[model samples]
Target: MSKKVIHKANTRGHANHGWLDSHHTFSFARYYNPERMNFGLLRVLNDDIVAPGMGFGAHPHDNMEIISIPLSGELAHQDSTGNKKVIKTNDVQIMSAGSGLTHSEFNNSKTDQVNFLQIWVFPKEQDITPRYEQKTFNPADRQNKLQTVVGPEKDAENIWINQDAWFTLGSLKTGFSEDYKLHKTGNGVYAFVLEGEVEIDGEKLSKRDGMGISDTENVSIKASSDAELLLMEIPMR
Candidate 1:
């Protein structure tokens, strides 16, 4: 494994397009800040809140891996590859914009607002065929343990990506603790807390807080209260 490098970034971006409010945890296109460009293979992490009946128009992408995790409310996704679906809380969606693809996302409801997380990762290779997939994950599966949601195998019971990485989600009760082993020897884990509090490798993470740890076989997490979290293991240089 590579040495661990922790990034405790402050909320660094604000972009309001009237209907969409986005917060950038890392620098993104046209919103570049060299120090916040990316971490390892993890490229983008955006917290988005969309107004009712509003969303992104069709946009094009290529050679990138995109993921959407709804925190609350619902999202309607449509792509050129003939995928049209509504994804809600506890649901995960992945789009491999390989070669090229166009898609649009909208808030599916006309009343309540929508909130979600959008993540982007660099692909191992370029120019493959574009694909789209979404799945509803039972929150119960993560009540007291980590539930693997994305890996490198379709037969692994979840979405698969073309990288030596794994994504897990968990919910812990007060005083609960869990340990996670690295999926690959040279990979690392990025722990992102969605709610409540937790301590990882002695570092405290509150809601929306994250930490990256590597060079270890496993890392420990202890919740101070009921908490929801996402752990992503990806290759490091």
Candidate 2:
């Protein structure tokens, strides 16, 4: 039997520091939810708003796939791999923290707050080599359809991670519909709505809403209004 989990927009854990406002979909930092820990191999999912000139300091990670998706403003990233870059809207950044790595992120603009999503997934194979990658995605390519932004293929037009999971983005017009098929059996899909409203199968979701669909090959998504969306397919193990 297929299983589904719906996460409401406001049901997530929220933390407010002087320079950071973050919402945790899974247990992280100070917010611990035994029931919300993880879905399949997907680990951390954090929606963050970083105040200008403020952000996370150097942090260490190992044997994890870390992905960052910027929504607005600029995010400056610096890592131990000698990679320093600024990520803007529609840009995706990924790091394979194999073995170990340290990095920091900050809002580049002096007056603008930067909003972004930080996600982590367990690696299929651990302790290989630390690596960093980022890319700019043309939003037009995702208009009314899915645009793959992260995958396992090196020749693909997206960032590659150290796992079999795939991440995609979509922008749909009102009343438009789309379908997403899993790349591998036993993999689950996590669909998130960034703007407007949408329906997965027959369940309605709104801005900042998320849904996990498993035990199925594909899912039907319908937009009730113009909507921006993200979909992640991950291994069930």
Candidate 3:
């Protein structure tokens, strides 16, 4: 039987630091819910909006694979690996804080706010070497179908990560349906609705809602309206 967990949009933890407004899907910083710690190897999922010219200062992290997806505006990133770049909508960025590293992110605009998703996954192995990568994806590719943006390290078509995880994005019209097969036998898929409404495994979800499915080989998804969806398939362990 398939096991499922739902995280309603209203239930997410919120923090407003004047310049930074963030919502957490799992326990983070001051939002500590013992039962909401994580979903498999997916450690953190944060929806962040930064005011013009403001953002996070340098912070240290180790043994974590960090992925950033810009929703609107642009984000400036700098890391200890000597990488510096600006990512805008349709761009994806990944940083492997293997041993240890410090990084900072700031809004690249002075008049517009920047919104993005910050996701962290526990790596399969630790203490390797720090690295950074970024790429822009054509939004047209995801129209009415899934586009793989991040995949296992050996995958040559998309950005590579240090774990057996696959991240896909889709834009669907009402009544459109799709099936996502698990990438690994013991992996789970976390579905997050970015816009409009969707039904996953028969559970209806609206914008910003999240659902985790496990013990299943494949998942069925149908759009209730024009929608945007993100699916993260990661190891259950």
| Model 2 Cα shift for residue 171 (angstroms) | 0.7
User: What are the lDDT figures for the candidates, one per model?
Assistant: 0.86, 0.94, 0.96
Residues 1-237 of candidate 2 have per-residue lDDT tens digits of 778999898999999997999999888999998999998999989999999999999999999999999999999999998999999998999999999999999999999999999999999888979999999999999999999999999889899988999999999999988678889999999988999999998899999999999999989999999999999999989
Candidate 1 stretches with Cα past 4 Å from truth are 1-10
lDDT string, candidate 3, 1-237, tens digits: 999999999999999999999999999999999988999999999999999999899999999999999999999999998998999999999999999999999999999999999999999889979989999999999999999999986647789999999999999999999889888899999999999999999999999999999999999999999999999998999
Off by over 4 Å in 2: none
lDDT of 1 at 152: 81
Candidate 1 lDDT, 1-237, residue by residue in tens: 435555553555778888988888788756777877777798888889999999999999999889999999999999999999999998999999999999999999999899999999888779989998888899899998989998888687889886777999998999988778787887888888889988987788888887878788898889988999889888875
TM-scores, in order shown? Answer: 0.94, 0.99, 0.99
Candidate 2, run of 10 with poorest lDDT:
175-184
Q: What is the lDDT of residue 51 in candidate 2?
A: 99
